[model samples]
Target: MAASSIANPRSDTANQVWTDLSPLLQFNNMEIINVADGVTSFLIHPEITTTVGRLKHCTFMAVLWEIWCSRNRARFQGQDMSAKHIINRSMLSIRAITIAANFQKILQPWLVALCQSNSRNEILKVLIPKVVRWLTPPPGRLKMNVDGAFNMTSGEAGGGGILRDHKGNMCCAFAKPYHGLNSSLSTEALALRDDLSICCSKGVYEVLLETDSLNLLHIATR
Candidate 1:
């Protein structure tokens, strides 16, 4: 269908999607990850993430529910975002389904129903909490405790942690906004040292403390 577009642009704008421009058709080797039995999530290999993936793949997830509405303009009548409603009216479209399929094959009707397009402090108030909840592992699920902070341009900082069992569930969480002022040498050292202090205070005998700073690990251990 799209192949016919290059030669005949004005001739066919209805009934047939010009195959050539279809994102699915253009990106030949891209693979979609199966997240569940019926759901799919596709990540453009990192190499392409900065390009087409950023443009197309990212769009579908951003304001997924709202876009789902807009894409189905005829059915939805208009895109709507209402905080009080908890759920908005939307007409699903082929475009929306394709986008969902690109991300994960399992597009819950509820997710498609409540997803909104706005991304701001106000929206984050509504969105981030939900995302965090979704990302939170269930009870007894294995989870990692991670934290980060900035001290000097490259110096001492504070950190946080959370404990979880084998099921990706977070058993505990912790954080400290500011550790102290130090050089690059003491930044991570302070974080690790502080983490240890916290563990002792809370009586956490066994847990994982994760950090991205190599220098801190070295200093804290020594």
Candidate 2:
């Protein structure tokens, strides 16, 4: 398999990927002569036959897929992103999978214990409160908050905004549907423009604008 990977220029540069990954695999006690051998070892292990093991095995496969994709991009698109980038991406993917597995392991037992207790007071004690405080505008200024949502299946998007006074009273609210937007950035920009236009129509010059999108805020401020 390693020879085939090295010989076939169209194949996934797996030999290089394996070379970069070998140390980590050895550290995990999964050292092998080749990728196929490593997979065979995983299949034969009893722990790997369990549900969580299967997920880990799948994550390993996904790493290989990502490596192949990166190699193809470098070969075809002339985007020679380094092997270290591929390794970093794989590590992040595996870390996310591990975190999800640990979260599920803890959540199942927590849910069971919660059900067994069935006391409102016990539940309230375990729950943590999250509070969000909205800032108010100065005396003469009107605050406008804008947001956007997209529907992937329908290829449609919508944007809305609310104008509020210093005392947090809503002066006006507007929503508009959009079509054929390629990305969330476009929708956010459109939302901001729509809110600005509404404010202009309402003759409110002193304005404070807010949005949850960091990209939009950066662009607007710049």
Best by lDDT: 2
Report how far off residue 192 is in candidate 1 (Å).
Answer: 2.3
Model 1 TM-score? Answer: 0.34
Clashing pairs in 2: none
lDDT of 1 by residue, 98-165 (tens): 34444332233423333423321222122222111324445533444555666565354666666667
- Candidate 2 lDDT by residue in tens digits, 167-188: 9999999999988897888998
User: lDDT of candidate 1?
Assistant: 0.41
Best of the candidates, TM-score: 2
Model 2: residues with Cα > 4 Å off, grouped in runs:
1-130
Estimate the lDDT of model 2: 0.64
User: How far out, in Å, is residue 204 in model 1?
Assistant: 2.2
